[model samples]
Target: MTYCLGLLLNDGLVMASDSRTNAGVDHISTFSKMRVWEKPGERIIVLLSSGNLAITQAVASQLDDQIRLPGGEKRKKGSTLLTVPGMHAAAKLVGEAVRKVYDNDAGSLQQHGADFIASFILGGQVKGGPMRLFLIYAAGNFIEAGPLTPFFQIGETKYGKPILDRVIAPDTPLPEAVKCALVSMDSTMRSNLSVGLPIDVLVAKTDAHRVFHRRSIGEDDPYMMGLRKQWGDGVRRLFSQLIDPRLDE
Candidate 1:
């Protein structure tokens, strides 16, 4: 299990993902779930993945490999993320990568009684295009984020969704959105062992076509520690101040 989230606000986008992967309690390890491709002034793409580690990695590899192919081969394969015309086209490439991975591995995994499970959160901006965010599922289908729904989560999502639901909006400031993402990630880490530390966070300003801020937050990061403590205490205090329900009524 993992927890990956992306927020699309008017100012820009915020993306975050945890780094823990485990086959069992005894076999736990850390693997970053964030993949980034940047072309400076041209385009910047960030991918957050969750689900079967192997499948996610394979999908990411497909995208990378496609871009490295020679010109003729690349064109035969269609547009790669870097050459895609817009964010929407970039999303289509991601979906195609997911389906390609499924086609190659799903049968073998199912034969072993395992399901082909994977999902991704793709967020970025291409030159001449508005910033966009998408949630790509196992079947290669996807949905774009919009004003009404300005955020998306791809894995172990329930633990971190409430804060986003209450705090995120299309107009939320980029800095505030980053803080909310961290708080949401902390909430999940506290409640679930499968989703954990060493979170990767990326922030991009609209039309910048470059990552504005990026960080790898470890277990001892000072800001994260303070935010965790403050948020927990504030929540407890708020809960205590709430009026108790009238049982007799």
Candidate 2:
């Protein structure tokens, strides 16, 4: 299981992912689910993935192969992340990568009684276009974030979604969005043992065409610890203050 989220705000983007992967209680491990492709001032592409680990990793590796050559120069032969004209095209490239991986591995996995499941949250800005965000599914299809839906999440989403729904808006400030993302992740981790630390978070400013800030938060991080305690206590206090409903009334 995994928990990956992306927020598309007027200020830019906030993307986060938990690093825990588990087959069972006895078999638990951590793997960062975030992949980044950047061409400095030219473009910045961030992808948050969930579902089958193998499938997601293969999709990311496929994109990385086409993105640049051994010497780091951009590839010109195919529609690589670096060659995509805008965020939409970049999203299509990601979708295609997902399909390619599915075609090659899905049948084999099914034969072994497994399912070919994968999802991605793609967000970033191209040099000439507005910042955009997309949710790409296993079937090579995707939906863009819009005014009414300014965010997307994949995997173990139920526990964390409430905070985002209550707090996020298109006009939310970047710092506040980042804080919200962290809080959401904390809530998910508390409810689902499958989702754990450390979390990877990325923030990009609109039109910057590059990441504004990136951090990996672990259990010992002071700010995360403080936020978790404060949020928990505050929520409990608020709940206690709410008048109890009366069935008789």
Candidate 3:
């Protein structure tokens, strides 16, 4: 289990993922679920994955291998992340990668009574194009984030979705959006044991074609601790101020 989120704001994109994977009480581990590919001034692509860890890792490996191939080889063989002309094409490339992995391992997992479960959030900018964000599923299908729905989430999403729903919009500032993402992740971590510490966050400014900020937030980060405390207190105060229902009257 994990918690990964991506926000598409007018200023740019913000992505975040928790680093915990738990098979059982005793079989827990930390693995960063964020993958990034950048061509400096040319393009920047970020992937946030959740679900069966093995399947997600395999999909990411497939994309990485394709990215490392020579340009002509990549084009001749298939579409690599770098070869995609736009964000939509890049999303299709990711979807195909997910399907390829499912074809290879889904049946074997099914035989053992395990399901082939995986999902991804892909967001970034390609030179000459506007920044875009996508939510790719296990079946080689995806949808882009738009004005009505300017964000996506995978894994333990329910615990953190309320804040995002109330705060995010197309015109939200990048910094505020990133803060919202962290607050979202923090909410998940507090309510769920499966989503743990050392979160990875990446932010990209619109048309920058590169990552503007990246950070690994650990358990002891002062800023995170303060934010959590403040948010919790604020929520409690707000709840207390609300009028109670009077059924008897």
Query: Which residue pairs clash within candidate 3?
Result: none
Q: What are the per-residue Cα lDDT tens digits for candidate 1 across 145-240?
A: 999999999888888889899999998998899999999999899999988989999999888999899999998999999999999999999999
Error of 3 at 141 (Å): 0.6
lDDT of 3: 0.92
lDDT for each residue of candidate 2 in 100-197, tens digit (9 for 90 to 100): 99889999999999998899999999897999999999998999999899999999999999999999999999999999999999899998989999
Task: Report clashes for each candidate as comma-separated counts.
Answer: 0, 0, 0
Task: Kindly report which residue stretches of model 3 are placed more than 4 angstroms away from their true locations once superposed.
Answer: 69-78, 247-249
lDDT of 3 by residue, 155-246 (tens): 99999999999999999998899889999999999999989999999999998898899999998999899999999999999999999998
CA lDDT of each candidate? Answer: 0.91, 0.92, 0.92
Model 1 TM-score?
0.95
| Residue ranges of candidate 2 with Cα displaced over 4 Å | 68-78, 246-249
